[model samples]
Target: MKVKIYPIVRTAAVAVLLSGVSACSKMYDVKPQNVVEAKNTYQNIYDADAAVTGVYGKFLGLAGQYEVLNELRADLMDVTPNAGADLQQINTHNVLPGNAYADPTPFYSVILNCNDVMKNLTIMHNTQKLTDADYNQRWSDIGALRCWLYFQLGLQYGNIPYVTESFSDVNTVKDQSKYPRIALADLVKTLIAFMEALPYKDPYPAANSLITTIDTYPSKMFYVNKNCLLGDLYLWNNDYHKAAIAYKNVMETSTPNGPGDSYNYYNTYTLNSGSDNDAVTQSAWLTFFSRSMQDREYQTEWIWSMVFDKAFAPENPFINLFANSGGKYLVKPSQTAIDNWSAQRQTDGTPYDYRGINTTYKMVNGQPVIMKFLYNYVNASTGIPSDPLAKNGRWYIYRTPTLHLRFAEAANRDGQTKIAWALVNAGIKGAYDDTTIPDPTQRRITNLPFPYDFDARKLDAPTIRGKYHRNLGVRARVNVTNLDVSLQQNANFLAMEDNIINEDALELAYEGNRWQDLMRVALRRNDPSFLADKVYNKLLKDGNPAAATVRAKLMDPKNWFLPFN
Candidate 1:
């Protein structure tokens, strides 16, 4: 068996795992564990690859927080009676520094590992221990992962300690003079610079198993897509045009065929419901979130995924958090969220969104547990194995739908409201017909740019129709009616942006991005009421008496972030 290469990270990093981590200047300074000597580390390619895997192991530890911090604090999720006081505080937007989820140690631990991995990988390349190709791919993967972690930290805490170098002494990081705290905006700038400069912005080549297969799972889902992440960083940085370019890059993937090519990884869950394959259509949507990374069709829809297996690591925490039966059921979909899903129209001309009931979350034992994570876990017909399996499954940190939604957000802000609206309701083709835009001048303005115009059916007679027409709108994929864009001639981007945010809730809710979506939009408009009203309305639905106070607190931008102690 190959050696399990633990990262030779800083003493402070390992200490955080032992004794908790705090967000204050004073950090955990205990003697480091798992300290491997330099001579024993990164001796070859496999060794360096193992070190990156170790970083992912640390990332997996933070997977549960991706849901808790992002979802629990927002309107789509609510704490149940069984939830701890800490969870309650987060839901109410009154997070205490002492709240367990508020601690920054896990994030820093992963960041420190990423720092050490990059430092060692550089050393390996310099010493001729690795090929230039191997060096670039590994180095860029670790760099992107670090950038993603920092981005998440910045979003959650507002201002965070931006440390990029790897060190041994805990005091080195504690010395705020050298490594000062930077706001989310500055961090985004640094991250964009670092990622944009990486030589290999793509995933590891086929020969490199690090980017391909990890046991039964694809490591591509494990590593963050550099462009997808850059797109998100640009979004948070509020550079809409650049953000649109970044997301567009992910869709095209620098390929010859463009976004229409089936080879694209940013493909969404296509809904092709028909009499001949109604169940098959539902199953296609079902496997979109599973341990079935082996499924090529579903794999296209996943940009980044976290693997959890009962046989490999401990059982995933999601079952305990989201499953109603054989689970703690700490939190569930909020009543308002349920109502939103109920509000959508399914393709079968049904009243409710097919994704909402029995798909996203299901009624089991009289409780509505979040089913996205624990999908197919119950022995219901949806079970993947067709038998009871452990609750362990994959958690999507980023996926296809998320990329499209974010792209629409940036595009709308960049003055492509019709194109953005199309991405949400009718898709690139459906939203751009002569009737959709009507006037030739308006059509020209609403026309999708190169990659986004996958279908490319224009007024030109030759290029307007073909088999290359696969870009289904988010709502259209679910059998919902196309949005009425006829009345939107005078609509500003902000109003369209609000509609996009609503689409975000309908399309990508409970995937650990709901809160950030609400916060980002609110911050962009400088309208506290945009965000406050949503959470306040959620509280009123749940009958939480703190609704008024929570809404009042969120009216200030300061309360949008969690406390650091």
Candidate 2:
């Protein structure tokens, strides 16, 4: 069940050569033949840069991990009967050690790559080739990526052996006694301390950003930005006050075109125009997962995304699971997910949730197929449909809406219900209408002001011009209906909390993060029944007979964390 650290040297070296993908082809195109060659690889900044890129390449190959670990366990998705035994196990919470998705080796291998970059890059930096700022920035990037690996491990496995240095040989790795598993709480504390010590900024200027060679790198608001991880850790650690502050920094700095910002939210594609068809209604959100916007560097909302170049990196397996034309269509939307959207109706009896409108599955005869991962659309210019085999969608690690929602959760927990309500409102409004609207007076709509700050004041302004933003009949401003009245209003606050949770499910559907959201609320309230009830309800709605068993197990805190092996 534990990752053998010493034997990893051999495995790590093989992985680097096998997966040594880089955005800057000139530097990382060639893989090191041996550990000596790998050590020699970082002779200068170029080599150091290549080493950094290799770490990212290792991280990028985890799109499937996000889908399985983060999403599949949650109620948003149901496993297709023929999806595979492994995927079905994940859906049913009957995962075995042999489950293909249970392999933590890839994540451990990723940590090894980060360790390699940290060691070699430091050696090269000591040579004075990199400026102090450059060295710190690059080192910080490596540290953040390593922290990301540990964070994922902590979530997947309750506790794991914490290792900082690269293993020398198989003998060292074989000695489990040398690397004892550390509690996730302790690991979070360690990461927070390490991250806080580094000279960092939430939204580091895009020009001096890390991973400089890659234009599409999530230099703007990704986990690479320590604040993102800091917020995540703080949230997991239940440090609501600190978590709120961390998330605030992300909102103010990392938001697309926010104060002192430089990178676009997403570059290649624009938001949905709210056209009368699925194509336009889903465009703003769907574009983020489309192949067309994979590497484009323009106006974007992608806080951080895994880069996958069709011509450069290996094929993303997520495409095989999510995409329709070329995918196995293994994962499908659950009945609960369908009901989540169906329950919410606009004034006109239409779905008020645009995301639900676009993300829900449509029935083909008797079979229901999820379309969130299927980005098959007709090319506007080429006049041809997109290829299903195209693995173009970049795996989003963090985005503006999700961050806003996270901040809302933290804020709500900290009793800043207004701020929490505002965060949720912003996510909903901006979800489908992120297109840059002109601010003639340089104010709200035109200036593209940060949505997270909307709760600062109580005012009724003209809503953005979109079908989802207005009342079809009245043609007046859209009323914010979901915001809670006040914290003293217990029922209202609970309703707001529920709204935020649903919003997370709505905004972050198949991209991964559903189960964790449920866990966060459950743990925060110290109410095992809360988590159990929700999961049980979803399972029953889906007609799964294991609902009672899963509910009983979930009532125990130990069962909160999935079994490592």
Using TM-score as the measure, the top candidate is 1
Model 2 is weakest, by summed lDDT over 10 consecutive residues, at: 470-479
Per-candidate count of clashing residue pairs (backbone under 3 Å): 2, 13
Tens digit per residue, CA lDDT, model 2, 116-148: 667766776778767777777778878887887
TM-score of 1: 0.86
Q: Say what the RMSD of model 1 is.
A: 5.9
Q: What is the C-alpha lDDT of each candidate?
A: 0.70, 0.58
TM-score of each: 0.86, 0.77
Clashes of 1: 2
Q: What lDDT, from 0 to 1, does candidate 1 have?
A: 0.70
